[model samples]
Target: MKFLLTSGGVTNPSIRSALDGLLDKPVDQCTALCIPTGMYGHPWVGPGVKAWEFVAGKEEGNPMVGLGWRSMGLLELTALPSLPAEGWQPAVRDADVLLFSGGDAVYLSHWVRESGFADLLPELTDTVWLGMSAGSMVTTPRIGQEFVGWQPPGGGDDSTLGLVDFSIFPHLDHPALPTNTLAAAETWATGLGGPAYAIDDDTAIVVTDGGVEVVSEGTWKALAM
Candidate 1:
């Protein structure tokens, strides 16, 4: 399996090159499926609008558009929960990459399991799994409480897909994500039973076949926890 896990989506040149290398094809020839389900879990501002709409409106200038993929298709699992696997499997199979946008990790994890995408992932060997923020966090066995500042709803099965053995804390030191400071990351890391990583916007951790590489234009650190 291959993974391009980032704190922010394709934020710098090094990450872009890493993504291109993972695809092993010209950018114009690769197709991507954008999964924005995670955004729905975020807190909404306005009163009347639906959650999905509220989240969609906030992503007006997403950086994914400039990544130069041949085509990018939006797939909102929450909006189409009833759609059969057959309806979406073809899109997953055809795409060269699965782009998961940032938002609430627990919400994304819940949907991945409920929508059956978690089961489908292991089978998609040829498609690279690309994630940003909470998108990257959901691939691990568990998302630390300090990372999100609150417990997941229902408090049951908070475990994620466990696609990777270690956990990830994104947006470290980002002013917008104040809860994810480097000091908080260190605290989170101390409680982890295994390894973890703290990354800023311009860094990414690329995993290929079982080996890991850090591709960055900014900062990142591997937690010895």
Candidate 2:
């Protein structure tokens, strides 16, 4: 699978073109899967999932398809009413492309686990992988700085889908998250001894079978784990 990972949601509309390039295209579009943005809880996810399902001609039944996806907070799922016992994994298995959006990484991880989506996501490596902020962070084997202070507050065990070898300190230096998590990112890099990427909202780190590239408006820093 090819990947278009970003620090935040696709603020620059033009970036969608860049994202399309990652896919094999029209014929192979069935293989695409969009990861749920970990904000607004599942309320936001209803639509993103709906869009793809609509395009795919599935037409199951999930809200948010045309209403414009909300900033679905990952933690929001915890408060949502219970899902069917069959759970989310069934739908996930039937899909191909996975799109991820920015939000709370901690809550997103939990939903994957509790919803049984975690086990179903591994084979997606051959499919298209798209991520925003928290979505991008969860792609790495170990999520970066956000998980450093993780506890009950930061959410525990930042277990991502492991699509990438590195972690990310997303939105670093942004007014919303001004403090740079260099220390935490470096610590993860050193421990894993692989490589980690740090990005701001204006930047994106694109990864493919070939290599990793930086795309966006700003410079990014990477460290070898």
| Candidate topping lDDT | 1
Winning model by TM-score: 1
Error of 2 at 157 (Å): 3.7
lDDT of 1 by residue, 1-225 (tens): 589999877877899899888986887899888887786676641122433342343443335544667887877766556897788878877888887877778888888877777777877887898888888988988787654532456665446778888999887788766787778888888877789999998899998886888998888888955
Clashes of each: 0, 27
In model 1, the worst 10-residue window by lDDT is 45-54
Candidate 2 lDDT, tens digit per residue, 1-225?
Answer: 677677754545434555656655542334433444364343433446643453333333211112132221122234323765355444445444466655566667666666555565565565655676676776777775445322345456655667677777776667655456666556656765467787776677778878887777764678883
Model 2, C-alpha of 155: deviation from truth (Å): 8.7
TM-score of each prediction:
0.87, 0.63
lDDT of 2: 0.56
Superposed model 2: Cα runs more than 4 Å off: 26-37, 40-96, 145-159, 181-193
